[model samples]
Target: MEDRRALATLPPLRGRVQQDAPLAPFTWFRVGGPAEWLVRPADVDDLLLLLRDLPESVPLSIIGAASNLIIRDGGVRGVVVRLGGKAFGEVSVDGDGIIAGAAALDAVVAEHAAATGLAGLEFLCGIPGAIGGAVAMNAGAYGSEVKDVLDWAEVATPAGVIRMAAQDFAFAYRKAVLPARGVVTRARFHARPGDAAAISTRMAEIRAAREATQPVRARTGGSTFKNPPGAKAWALVDAAGCRGLVRGGAQVSEKHTNFLLNLGGATAADIEGLGEEMRARVLATSGVSLEWEIKRIGEVTP
Candidate 1:
């Protein structure tokens, strides 16, 4: 209701637009409230046109796989656009390089690369988020980050689409510096020729490591906080004795202190509050202050 005029104008949209759509179902944590307006564009052109034609007053936000995300209980205001289906889900091979749509899952891209004998991207198999969010935050695992292999990414901004190079991302630790509200649509990565069998074996090992170290079965956001400089975040959290700490229905994953889980019937506020408490506890135990890696959006209920 905050942007009523803008919402009313969406009926003519080429894509599906729903009012008060349930957002919790889209997320890994299975929490949060509704999306005031959820936009599902038909394709890249539809999305670009929608972004161009829409009023500037109506705030727009983008989401992908919903992994590593927490939408607050009050719900998101303005418009929430998610790229999905065949339109944004394609990953194509180009010689030793590959182009992945933003909506494409990291696992799928990894598999594609493996099948195509593309090495240097096996690490992406461990990341749970889609390529869009992965490029946005430079998501990675297994000693290889996105910045290391990403040649360029195509992003849609308020002004227009731009092909952003690796240097333009200004990536560091676990963050990327891009224009405000610029959404990634596609990414290009360069890989070397390798044996498909070897690539598959590496991906299998990554899967095993993830299963052993992370709470893959829990309703949780992956990696609650970024590891501070030289220290592992989980180590600090463990030292603080905050492992298995609980708040409301949410609890720190005992399997990995870096992950926070919603143990059924948990509120978004509960998860966020638990994260803050863990942060404080870790700070109290160690001098290092852990920065949140998970993206929290939307508002709290009034």
Candidate 2:
């Protein structure tokens, strides 16, 4: 049983809080058990204060849109912080720069930038995650990545709120080397100007390309694993004879081998088990290890 003593003393929050909330409602996969305490912060200040005041023993996990996440079936203990409403979904454009709140969707950012004739963020149109997630994972598509245009990002740390320059967060393929204690709140990106018609055309082309190749419409996380140097993970998986492979109700996507699809009634364990099986098979056949791109959180049911 969760103790409500700590929460009772804190002043009322601008956001909503629910005890024993079902997490599946917030995730794209529509799977997962309940969160012990689910809190949606109204803004950056709300989030920081909540984090600062919460007891050290109470665990906290920050989630953006749950686009690349899998919360296990046994459920997450302690608190789950999700940024909500306009406080964390603002997007603004100034001159050659774009400012986005952490909870803003990547597709919305892309559209906003493209409307202003910004060229670089067109790649974001193909990504289906929040700005914070894009920052955390260095999400990318086509030939561009978030790191390429990122000027700076604002993050809340255990110490305090800090503005971190792009260099401060060392970035690599689909990963950021921020201090493990940091959590992003917002980001600023700079892009070159382009013809409005051309930008729109490019975004449409990218969207079409993704639809043609990926299971974009399905209830699934984007990619399962990153491609190793000079090799594609999907090809390795396909070569391992795992294409259209099934484990319980989860299956390797027929459209894209790197994608794993939940064919209704699938559990997180089933999905993760299939992913592990694919990795093991691929390693055995290709002599190379695959790294999971999808972030897994919470405990597995025993």
Candidate 3:
């Protein structure tokens, strides 16, 4: 097969590489098919080598945390790179700045910053996913966004790694114009000295609020759709009577209409189908089309 030949042509790597690696376990929903190739680079050098020499015919996809994502059942083609290990998960602080590897979970970064008496990043405790995905999507919660504090981010492209300033990202609500095929490796966020007690209190409040309102324990992907301008996505879903709606084994979370859950035996199709139905219902009732906040990838089953 072409995939096998493409694998053969890859330059030697220090990282782990696999053909037909199961991707379901890597995601929160616990569904979807295997990836054509799953690669975990040992370090930045190893990642650079793979990126610089990968065949042009093959496609490359980057995933992080797999928290707010849905990989379709037909699986992903070409290469899927998942950054991990201490090299990509380290979080440290220097003076008024915090440096976090792209693989670092947003909550871990928030904790690290708070431990060092740094404020302004406590909002990260409320956002799911890793720093890389957060930066790529301009993720935000509790009235703050990544763009509000990010100083700069380093991204790796086939050409080479480049350090881009926050302004260079041209961040918009829940989106950024990151370079095509560029993978975020790390980011620096601006912080300021604040009362440690105050920061900790803020984070705790966020955690409590999330637990009360969201389906934190279910097999679910966080927030199914983006909030339309001047309107809330969850309210629209509830208004359309989509709360607890079901398709196959997937159901809309009764606790939070914005979340879609896989009740043990759901397929990727079932979850995605339920989301489409929710959108249709909302559009029909509210005349506002919902945009997906969760990233969905790979081919649908034929």
Candidate 4:
């Protein structure tokens, strides 16, 4: 284990640092345990100083809104950084381009751009994540992905901060091949102009589609599995008769088979166990191996 004492004595550091911070409040599922040390950096300077001074042995995990994550019940070790305040949530429009801080909500940025009659970012209206997460996951909806509109991003590297162009980010279907240790601080997007009414209509349609097909009302980490090539994960799960299946408090969503819902009080192990079962059955029945879309971190209870 790393030294918790050092973190405690590191002055104010301009941001609040809490010991054993409950993670359930931060995550969408509302089921995770605590983070050993949760640090909300007030600004980039605060973050850089903390990172520079912290011992290399002490690990750090960066999270945005926690929409596509599963923090296990045993809690995460080391420091968990969640950027906050005006510095990390700023969004500004410069002509046809938009600059957003890491903590800016995707929906907020999309609405702002849309209000300005920008069209390219309408797809982001349906994504429930922060700008950093949207950039990291290459998050998409309907037909457009973040890669289509992203101009560049600013990242905090071990050596220092650096700006990376869109081409510099190795973007795959739903993955960004940035260094695991790199922390994204801000991003820029290039959106084109379109009729604001049309964009709003399209956003509404997307929201309705999600409501009809996903368990959006339930505690969940969006889709549990990614669609494999040539087949949709949800269709495969439904075909395998996994829909509405329950294991403890975790249930394979009746609305969307690929989504696992925390009906009320589900533990991380229960959800993971149900996921394993779904995978096994899907493989046995359809000969297709489903890959998880949601990132799982931390540990499970013994």
Winning candidate number (lDDT): 3
lDDT of 1 by residue, 1-302 (tens): 54787667653778888989999999999999899889998887778777777787887889899999999999998889999858888899988888999999999999999988999999999999999999889897999999999999998876789999999999988889878678889999999999989999999999999999999998999999998888899999999998899999999999999999999989999999999999888888787788999999999887
TM-score of structure candidate 3: 0.98
Better by TM-score, candidate 4 or 3: 3
Residue 84's C-alpha lDDT in candidate 3? Answer: 93
Residue 256's lDDT in candidate 3 = 96
lDDT of each: 0.90, 0.87, 0.94, 0.86
Off by over 4 Å in 4: 5-12
Instruction: Write the number of the candidate with greater TM-score, choosing between 2 and 3.
Output: 3
Steric clash pairs (candidate 3): none
> Residues 76-117, candidate 3, lDDT per residue (tens digit)?
998999999477999989779899999999999999999999
Give candidate 2's error at residue 34 in angstroms. Answer: 1.1
Candidate 2 pairs with clashing backbones: none
In terms of TM-score, how similar is model 4 to the real structure?
Answer: 0.95
lDDT of 2 by residue, 95-167 (tens): 8989999999999999999888887899998899999989988999899999898999999876678898888
Q: Which 10 residues in a row give candidate 3 its minimum summed lDDT?
A: 1-10
Q: 1-302, model 4: which lDDT tens digit per residue? A: 34777665565787888889998888887777899989998788888777777766777888889988888999988889998737799999989988999999998998899889988887887888899988888898888888999999998766677899998888888889786478889999998889999989888888888888777888988878888999999999988889899998899988788888888888888888899999999999999999988888886888
Ranking by lDDT: 3, 1, 2, 4
Better of 1 and 3 by lDDT: 3
Best by TM-score: 3
